[model samples]
Target: MKAADLFEFPASIPFADFFRADALPWQWIGQIKKALASGFETNVPGSIPPGVRISGEVYIHPSVELPAFCSIEGPAWIGEGAQIRPGAYIRGNVIIGAGSVVGNSCEYKNCLLLEDVQTPHFSYIGDSVLGNGSHLGAGVILSNLRLDQKPVKALVDGKSVDTGLRKFGALVGDQAEVGCNAVLNPGSILGKRSLVGPLTPFKGTLGPNKLLVSKPETSIQER
Candidate 1:
């Protein structure tokens, strides 16, 4: 699906030009690196925490709330008013949009987080795109790679479409909600405002405004 269908890239974020609205959602994953490479000044706040370790070409707006203990690697951007909670691990090619929460004990890499997105507890977000206002409940994992380590394929229109990347994660659409402890399999696509019930192991594409529940028999219904 098109990135525009899922996210409206915020104007507050300087890298918006790197991500085109008409491009495929997964294609934006690769643009993360290119966005960081385009060059922006590194502007981390002067008040440094002893437990916080930041290295490489990183930009943290002065308004960002830094935790006492976190590891932030290079080629990353943390937007204004973002909260970086304790024990968060932010690796390369990551973008945290304004007012987003990079939650405690969460690991993020190669991802784009739009405005106000929250991954507020133990979650692994890699090679993915989180749209504006989307929230991930505690312990959610966006599994990026297949066990066989082949290119990830997305289920679009009930057919498999090759993504051509070995490490591709979920594309969480705008305002989507993923419940606690849910595992989103590789190349999963959650449409705008969709919800996945807690502890569900979900794959394939979920249409907009749908709710996927894992009962004795898994079922999808309008939210």
Candidate 2:
């Protein structure tokens, strides 16, 4: 399938140019950091509120809200109306979109969160692009490293295709919902409007309008 089948270009909040994929979609992962840095060339206007520790260079819109204990490392941009709750750590080179929520205990880096995306509560998202309105339930993790610590691969059309990147996380599509405690293995791709059940360890590609549930059936005898 083509890249356009998985991502909706209109849903992108910023850095829309990065979505143009001539070959494989994952090939654009390397360009994310560069795109983020260049956004600052236009004199990005922003302000930093109290109790927030800032390092490097951060471009935060005035309408963004940062609660206490929010630490941001730079080459990062926080969009309008974005909410970074307490204990939210933005490692570096992160693009948090407008009206998005990076909740408490969520650690993310080198990622693009589309508008209205919610990665709240104990989620680890790295080196990935989350589409608009996608939601990661509590304890959901987008894993970036494989066991070998080498380049991650994606299982597309029953083939394991190498992504050629040592650290690459999942590409979650627009309106996808990952249930609580779900772990998305490296190089996973979820198409638009997909659902991942709670406690599932997901890998490979799931097309749009799909529901994946992975849980062992529980049997109760007498109490």
Candidate 3:
């Protein structure tokens, strides 16, 4: 694999850098598409039945389970063994990865949820990237669009990176855990294995294995 394909992220780039208004222009949906395509063919191959209702172009892998109450809009991919519980709303251009769980009352739009990700309660995720093994606690929410309704951008290493999209949410790295009722603002990021305490409003970049109790008050500790 190409180095660009391996890490798929810029080198030494701060997580907060992904939100700067002047960050480099990156095609996030394209990256997600590439990632899904690189893996298996089905959205939830070997799990979901072909007769399930998929509105629009979608890819599902084997072993995916979609209950009748699940609504799926396409340009979306559901990976192997992923479960879409009842009352889940999955909008277009989202990638739900292998073994992930999208629980009841959860809504996802234009996001990338990597392998083993779980959002097990009332959650709203939009234009976000949830890394492998990440989990969002109950009532967690991510705000992708600014209230002013301007385009979203990313900051990388102090440089501005444009996302070229009007809506974009948080980017949670591998194994991150967001606590219940927490809010991840637009362009926020949680580095690998980071933890966010309940009711926290995360507005900036959180480093790898960081423990975030609230905004600007986070610690780095071993799990």
Candidate 4:
């Protein structure tokens, strides 16, 4: 499938021209940081509002609602109407699209969140791309690196395909719903509108419109 097929960019949240390059979705994964740097120099959407603690050259839109005490490093951009709650830490090389939320006590780095996406509450998103309207439930962790610190890989066409990046996280498609406390291992890809059960440990790829449920059988003996 094409990169456009994978990333659902809507009117409310549109990705910059960096994604317009003629490349596949997987090929662009490792190049996100460079793309962000280049975009920061050439074209950044908006301005950083006051009352936010900015350590680096962050580009935040005027319409964004950034609460006080939110820490933002440079090479990052937040779009219009985005909500970054207090204590939300945004590291460098990140792009948060319009109408998104990075809630309190959450941390995200080197990630892209499309418009209307919700990653609210106690989550960690790194080196990943979240599609439009996608919602990551509270306490979800998108694992960006493996234990061995080797290059991350994905299950594509039933084979392990190298992502060529030491730290690569999941690519969640549009409107996908991940339940609370889900752990998305390195190179996980959740297709459009898919549902991941609560507390699921997910790795590899889940196709579009599917339901992944984990029900552990429990014996009800004498209480």
Give the best candidate by lDDT. Answer: 1
The sequence of per-residue lDDT tens digits that candidate 2 reaches over residues 1-223 is: 6566666654434677766745466755676797776667322335456767888877778776668678888888888888889989999988878889989989988888878999889999998988889999999999999898988988888899888899999889889889999999999998888888899888888878888887664221211
How well does each candidate superpose onto the true structure, as a TM-score? 0.98, 0.89, 0.75, 0.87
Global lDDT of model 2: 0.81
What value of lDDT does candidate 4 attain over all alpha carbons?
Answer: 0.78
Please list the C-alpha lDDT of all candidates, in the order they appear. 0.94, 0.81, 0.69, 0.78
Task: Output the number of the TM-score-best candidate.
Answer: 1
Model 1: which residue pairs collide? none
Candidate 1 stretches with Cα past 4 Å from truth are: none
Encode model 1's per-residue lDDT on 1-223: one tens digit a residue.
Answer: 7889888999989988899999988999999999999999898778889999999999999888788999999889999899999999998899999999999999999999999999999999999999999999999999999999999999888999999989999999999999999999999999999999999999899999999989767899998
On lDDT, who's better, 2 or 4? 2
**Candidate 4 lDDT score at position 57:** 68
lDDT-superior candidate, 1 or 2:
1
Q: Please rank every candidate by lDDT, starting with the best.
A: 1, 2, 4, 3
Candidate 4 residue lDDT tens string, 1-223? 4456567555543345567535556555655577666645323334444656776666777676667667888778788788889889998878888889988889988888888889999999998889888999999999999999999988877888887889888888888888999899998888788888788888988887877867673121211
> For candidate 1, what is the TM-score?
0.98
What is the Cα-based lDDT of residue 220 in candidate 3? 53
Which residue window of length 10 is worst by lDDT in model 2? 214-223
Regions of candidate 4 where Cα sits further than 4 Å from its true position: 10-15, 39-51, 217-223
Which has the better lDDT: candidate 2, or candidate 3? 2
Candidate 3 residues 1-223, lDDT tens each?
1112212342211222232323222345335545434443333334554444567667766466567667788768776678888888888767777788988989988777767888999999987777777899999999887798887766555655666777778878778899999998877767677898999887766667778785466555666
Instruction: State each model's C-alpha RMSD to the native.
Output: 0.8, 4.7, 6.8, 5.2
